[model samples]
Target: MHARPEAWILSIGNELLVGRIVNTNASWLARRLTFMGFNVSRIITIPDSIDDIVLEVRRGLGKVRVIITTGGLGPTHDDVTLEGIAKALNKNLILNSEAYEMIKEFYNRRNMPLTRERIKMAYMPEGARALRNPIGSAPGCIIEVDSTIIVSLPGVPREMEAIFEEEVKSILEIIAPKISIVECSLKTRGIPESSIAPFLEHIAKSHSNVYVKSHPLGFELDKPILELRLLVSATSEDTAKGIARSIMEDIIREVLKLGGSTSSEYCV
Candidate 1:
């Protein structure tokens, strides 16, 4: 009944900016958030600068309901995401007892001594709650500012995904309880995107809850090929699934009418 919550993703690290490492975190988060019935508006990639991080966080908080940042949560000196968050929210950087305990246990299990750098990971923005990272030493954090939730996760793909699945997913489920999203994809062999553009536009306009997109795969012989993706969000699973099925049927019918052939089965 209400509009979907808007989300913004921020990726921080000089490695991402300089191409030293690929920024797969943004794409992963975007896809997951979209499938969870969120309107992912923008993805921003910035260097590991405290000022830039603080500025972006402040700006994103003004617009989006949820902001997720990946990277810069390590024990190294360049790991300044917590500092930026604290500065932006006017909160003090203090030792979080929960985070300290988690870090201590993790290091102790590995028989690693607690060094100064390792201790830095326990300092988080005041009033922030730590999200346990089962796979890594750096614990993620969540803080609310002006009713907007900001989540900080590690840069490593494995650790980030673990924290998101184990901790953040439950929080989001509670925040947006009424949304149910369903998606279906159709792969066609002989249809060009240009030919199906008008039909997709019409379907999108007529069905406001349904999102139709065409992705052009490479040509097969002389024929242009593409995949059609359909997504729907509703208050219930049955409604969402039904809408997606109906849309897929309509698309298949149109493709057949246009003399185009499909090589793949409908996937939901």
Candidate 2:
């Protein structure tokens, strides 16, 4: 069996750690990576500290095929993501002419003077490819270290998304797993997650490729509500969908047997 390429999303920013902002970038990247046929192994949010970024980057190297980091790519002092990544790989932070030109163009169009702080966005790890940001000034970067590819993107959601869609998506396609993923989600009532734990386990053991998980939504003592999600991957779309449908039917049958009601079934 062909193993799916594993990935990690490293979100950097003090605001995320302090709960000042939600980590939407991580979720967006996770969904995108999953759809691209990569298994997202971890989503980590850390402060805008160079030491912390270094630790995480070092940890992700050699462990996962891809590591995508969002945030700390701004012109501010706290934007040390690239610096940390450079230190982790023992590579020098050099002035990338392409990135500098992109940033210069952004400022030149608005008649804004290029300050040292603004030019800071042009420096990236040596041998990194600069990805243009269509909606923002900061240019993202892609660095290949042996078998691991690290992508550093701006913290801004729109800019990150633009760079991913226009630039990074094609690069990832070359390495993305050639598999089809089918997912099913169902809402159940009248039974708690504990009641269906055994059934889910049995299904998981029977079908190793399917991922089964339950999210409890309501109070167990009063009205039990759960969101059951199943994901399966196969070599083709028809096979994946067949497996997912079969698993969904089995789960529904088990839920009805346990005196539970299911609704809101959807596939994605």
Candidate 3:
């Protein structure tokens, strides 16, 4: 069987590295991509240096099918993500007319003056398609290099999310069709991760298609509460859900046998 297409997330910005901002973009992208049936292999954070950005993008390219980068696509001098990407792909940074118009319209509507600094947001790597940013001034860009898709989005969480939901999501669905991802969790009290490791291992080994994980929910009194997450991916929703349900049932039975009492059970 062919392996699922893999994805990598690159969060660019000096602020991320300096701990000025939390890197929530990687987490959001990972969850979204996983739901879309892509395996997120790695997430890398780098400073706002053109050399560093180029190096990271080059490394991710050819390794993963999709690379989503967030941050550094701004009007300030530090915003050099487009330059780095163009350098990495041996392309030129050109004024994207569509992106320029988008930014222009945004500022024009707000009665803001269009300055040279603001126009810098319109530049993108050559042959890149501009993705409309509904909530912000900077437009995202998408480029394909050697069969790998490179997507660059704004650093602002709100703008990134808007562009992703409105544009990137559909592009991803079209490029790498969606699979049914069914997941269910069972909460067990008075059980620790150590105690449930063997059962989870057994279930995972037996049902290769199902993913089993144990999350410890801290301590209640002296014992650790545990949540077992079961996930399965299939061509159809019913098939995926049925497999997840069956695997969850088996794990629950094992938990009960191990003297752990179950409390809540639900699909997610």
Best by TM-score: 2
Candidate 1 ranges beyond 4 A from true positions: none
Candidate 3, run of 10 with poorest lDDT: 1-10
Candidate with the larger lDDT of 1 and 2:
2
Candidate 1: tens digits of C-alpha lDDT, residues 1-268: 2278889999999999889988899999998888787888889998888999889999987678899999999999999999999999989999999999999999999999999999999999999999999999999999998878999999999999999999998898777547788878888878889999999999999988888899998898989888888878888889888888888888889999888987675645
The models' CA-based lDDT, in order, is 0.90, 0.93, 0.89
Error (Å) of candidate 2 at residue 86 is 1.0
* TM-scores for the candidates: 0.95, 0.96, 0.96
- Clash count, one per candidate: 0, 0, 0
Estimate the lDDT of model 3.
0.89
Tens-digit per-residue lDDT, 1-268, candidate 3: 1157999999999898889988898899998998788888899999899999889989987778999999999999999999999999999999999999999999999999999989999999999999999999999999999889999999999999999999999899986745778779889987779988987888888775678788888888887898888878888889888888888788788878888889789986
Clashing pairs in 3: none
**Candidate 2 segments whose C-alpha is farther than 4 A from its true place:** 219-221
- Global lDDT of model 1: 0.90
TM-score of 3: 0.96
- Write the number of the candidate with greater TM-score, choosing between 1 and 3: 3
Clashing pairs in 1: none
